[model samples]
Target: SVTGNRVAHTANIDRIAARGATFHRHFTPNQICSPSRATMATGLYPRHHGLWRNGVALDGRLPNLWQALSLAGYATKGVGKLHFQPLLAPVERDMPESLAYWERPGCEDWHGPYFGFDAVDLVMGEANEATRAGHYAAWLKRNHPEVVDLYEPDANPDSRAQDLNEVWKSAVPPELHYTS
Candidate 1:
């Protein structure tokens, strides 16, 4: 369906056809985030990496790309989301429902020196409008008490609805726009 979509005909994607090869047949060993990312890290499929879902962490024994790169004398720096486990104490599995407004936990520990990255800018939570205002948990308490009181598992009245490109454009700072 994505191949048939008109948006795929746009200039940016069209350039892929003009000078690049597109893999029509590719597969991820796991459909979920952590498992998929682990597969990427180790160049092994999910069965071998053993990361199953959002919360399950990769065993530290498994060799990862960062470790290999570091061994090769590369200065690793990660700037965006990597979805790896946090370095702090294993995160508490449970928090108030209000806290559920935040991003899923785990992988906060996966950044920085632990992962052989010399520098990292990590956000352990959702990077949306509500999160930009402050902690989504605290924002819920002060601003949208009614939404919080509803306790509906997916009631995000304050979350900003944004298109993918718009969200991406807004994320880039003016200073960096010229780099494109």
Candidate 2:
């Protein structure tokens, strides 16, 4: 099964179309992770939310989906990549630090416990660094061994023998779950 962009290209597009819904225009507030994710969480366009670039922290005063869901008494759990933060802030830093970047510091740590989500499997600002740790690459190796060699930078036998942990595959499924 494909995930992210691959799924967008193959399954997600067709699946949306199959439901008699047209896949119309889409736009991201920012091309980078932190800003785009802030837009999604806060339900505000980038200009209004002010997370215009990568490493920018989300303005905490803005009400995000989690808070809204919590107010509505829905169990709003967050998982995977929620890239909200002040530009260049790390996970450990809290509100005071965030206020330096933002005029109002609301949700200082995007991945830390916030709103009312009962459970969250979150990764903070470091997307690229996490990917290099080999979770996805390892899952790809186990599930699609045939193409493993194709991804190698060189033909060395030792390099090709790298094994990734199977537990990493236990994360979310590659497909989006929709409820009618």
Q: Name the lDDT value of residue 174 in candidate 1.
A: 27
The list of candidate 1 runs beyond 4 A from truth reads 1-19, 86-111, 125-180
Model 2, C-alpha of 102: deviation from truth (Å): 22
Task: Name the weakest run of 10 consecutive residues (lDDT summed) in model 1.
Answer: 171-180
Candidate 2 wrongly placed segments (more than 4 Å): 1-22, 86-92, 95-112, 124-128, 131-180
Q: On a 0 to 1 TM-score scale, where does candidate 1 land against the true structure?
A: 0.52
**Candidate 1, residues 17-75: lDDT per residue as tens digits?**
66887778897688877678788888887777777766665776788898889889998
Worst 10 residues of 2 by lDDT: 164-173
Going through the candidates in order, what is the number of backbone clashes in each? 9, 7
Instruction: Encode model 2's per-residue lDDT on 87-111: one tens digit a residue.
Output: 3454456432232323333332333
Specify the highest-TM-score model's number. 1
- Cα-based lDDT at residue 134, candidate 1: 19
- Evaluate residue 114 in candidate 1 and report its C-alpha lDDT on the 0 to 100 scale: 45
